[model samples]
Target: MIEILELTELPRAKAAGALVADILQTMRSRAAVGTNLLDIDEWTKAMIVEAGAESCYVDYAPSFGRGPFGHYICTSVNDAVLHGRPHDYTLADGDLLSLDLAVSLGGLVADSAISFVVGDARPAESLAMIDATERALSAGIAAAGPGARIGDISHAIGSVLGEAGYPINTEFGGHGVGSTMHQDPHVSNKGRPGRGYKLRPGLLLALEPWVMADTAELVTDTDGWTLKSATGCRTAHSEHTIAITEDGAEILTLPNHS
Candidate 1:
C-alpha cells in the first residue's frame, strides 16, 4: 500500500506529523526516574483524544503481536527495542527509554520515535549505543531526496552503524507511511545503493535506523511483541517520517516543541 499524498492533503499530513512529533518530544521530556511506562501510555491516549487523532497502536493486532496492542504508544526500556508494549514498569536512573508513536489526523498519519536515558547518570556504553543509532538516523536522512533509491538511504544508515561496530538487523526496518501507518518499500538498515524502488515526489517514508550494542540477533519478550537483544545487550532506535517533494526529502515529524 504505497500511498502518495495529493498536494491538497499534504498540509494535513504535515499537521499530523507535527502533532505526533510534539507529543513524542513532550513525553520524552516528562519521562524521568520513577516514571511509569503505563503512565506514559495513559498520557499519550489523552493527547490523541484531545487532538482528535487516532492511535495506530491501540487496535494493531498484526501476526507479530500477541493481540490488540491496547496501548497508545510503545514504551521500550533498555532491553526492549521494536514493538515495545507499554506495561507496568518503573523507569530507573540512567535507564535507556525509547518512545515510538504513530497517529492519524485529518485522514493522514505520521510515525516517529526517540531514545534517551533517564536521570543524570549517563553510562558510557549506553551513550555510545544511543549515539550510534542517532548518527545512523542522520545518515539515512541525508541519503533521502528526490529520485534517491531506498537502497541509497539504507546504505547511508548502515555505513554509520557498521563503522561504529554494531550489527544490523533487517527483520524490521523503516517503511513507506501514509493514510495508514506502515506501508510498502521496506527500507532495510543495511543495503547497497543503486537498488530497489526509485524515489519520487509526494511519497512518504519513515526512515528508522536502530541497532543493538553487540549482536544482530533478537528474541521476543514474554509479552509476545517487544524485541530484545539475544545477548541481552542494550539497544537504541531513532525514526522520523519524511515526505519527498520537488525540493528534496522533507521531514514531517519534527515536533515543534522539540
Candidate 2:
C-alpha cells in the first residue's frame, strides 16, 4: 500500500526515524571483533522495547523469507547483502558488517541500513564499496522532491553506482514506507528519469542503494534468509528514510553524530 502521512503524522514519523538512526549508530559502535551477531539482535530488541517501539522485522512473514523473521535486526556480513538473519557467528577483524533496521513508534514506521567495517582493519575494497553506496544514497535523496518522479531518484542513485563500477541488483531496492514497513511503489536502484510515480508532499520513501563488488547475482544462505553475492565478493549497502515536503525531501534517518 502507498501511504501518505498527514501533517500530524509527520512528527510521529520523525520520532520513529530518529529512533532507528540512533539505534543503528549505537549498534555500529558496539559491533567489533568477537561480537556475536546474535548479540546485536538482542541489543536491538532491548533498545526497541525501551523506546516503546515495535519491531517491523520480528514476526514478519514475507513471501521472500521464511515465516516469522524472529530477529530484531539484519546482520549481513562480508559478502552477505540483504535479508541477513542474525546468527551465532562472531565478527572478526576487518569484517564488513551491514545492519538493516526498521521499527514503528507512535503508529508510524521508519527503515534504514548502514554498512561498515567491524574492526580496525579496513580493507581498501570494503571502504570504497561503502563510500560508493553512501554517495549513491545522497544522490538519490537529492533527486527526490515534490513533483519529481520515482525514476529520477533511481537514475540519480544508479548513475553514482554505475560510475563507481559496481553491478546493480533490482530484485530488492527501496520502497514506500509508512504505518507499515514495506509498501509501494517499488523504487529500483536503476531507472530512467521522468518515469514511474510522481512524488507528492506527505509521501515517505526508503531509498537504498546496494552493490556487489563483482556480480549482481545473489545466492541465499542455508538459513533461508541471508542473501549473499554469487561470486562471494564483498558488498555494501546504504539506506535512509525521507519525507516529501513542499521545498524538497527531508531526510529523517540521519545519524545523530552526523
Candidate 3:
C-alpha cells in the first residue's frame, strides 16, 4: 500500500531511522574475521529489544522468500546479495559482507544496508563493487525530492552503476517504507527519467542500489532465502531511507555516532 505519512508522524519516522542506523553501525563493528553469522543475528536481536523496537525482518514472509524470515537482520556475504538468511558460517578475511536491516520504532519503520570487507584483507574487486553501490545510492538520493519522478531517482542510480561497469538488476531494488517494512512504489535500479510515480512531501523511500560483479542474474540458495549472483561472483549493496521534503530529500538512515 502507498502511505503518505503526516507531518505529525515524521518524528517517529526519524526515531525509527536513527535506530536502524545505529544498529547497522554496531553490527558492522562487531562483524570480524571469525565472527559467526548467527552471532550477528543474536546481537541485532538484543539491541532491538533493548531499544524497545521491533524487527521488520523477523516475521517478514514475502511470496518470493520462505515464510517467516525468523531472523533479526540479513547477513549477506561475498556472492550473496539480497534476502541473505543468517547461517552457521564464520566470516573469513577479505569476505565482502552486507548487512541489511529494518526496524520499527514509535510506530514507524526505516530500512538501510551497507557493504564492507570483513578483515585486514581488502580485495580490490570487492572494494570497487561496494564503492559503486554506495555511489549509486548517493545518486539516487540526490535525484529524490518533492515533485520528482521515481524514474529520475532510478535513472540517476543506474548511471553510476553503469559507468562503474556493473550490470543493473531490476528484480529487486528499492521500495517505500512506513508503518510496515515494504510498501508501494517499487524503485528500479535503472529506468527512464520523467516517468513513474511523482514524489511528494512526507513520502519515505528506501533507495537501494545493488549489483553483482559481472552479471545481472541472481540465483536463490537452497535455504530458499539467500539470493546470490548466478555466476558466483562477488556482489555489493548499499541503501538508505530518505524522506522527500520541501527543501530536498533528507536521508534518515545516516549513523548518529561518529
My TM-score estimates for the predictions, one after another, are 0.98, 0.99, 0.99
Give the Cα-based TM-score of candidate 3 against the true structure: 0.99
Pairs that collide in candidate 3 are: none
lDDT of 1: 0.91
lDDT of 1 by residue, 1-258 (tens): 778878788899999999998899889988989999999999999999999999999999998889898899999898888889989999999999989999999988899999999999889999898898888988888888888999999999999999999999999999998888889989999999999998888999998889889899999999888999999888999999998888888889886842
lDDT of 2: 0.96
- The model with the greater lDDT, 1 or 3, is 3
Better of 1 and 3 by TM-score: 3
Per-candidate Cα lDDT values, in order, are 0.91, 0.96, 0.95
lDDT of each residue in 52-114, candidate 3, tens digit only: 999998888899997899999999999999989999999999999999999999989999999
Candidate ranking (lDDT, best to worst): 2, 3, 1
Worst 10-residue lDDT window, candidate 2: 61-70
In candidate 1, where is summed lDDT lowest over 10 consecutive residues? Answer: 249-258
Candidate 1: where are CA atoms >4 Å away?
A: none
Candidate 1 clashing pairs, residues 3+ apart or interchain: none
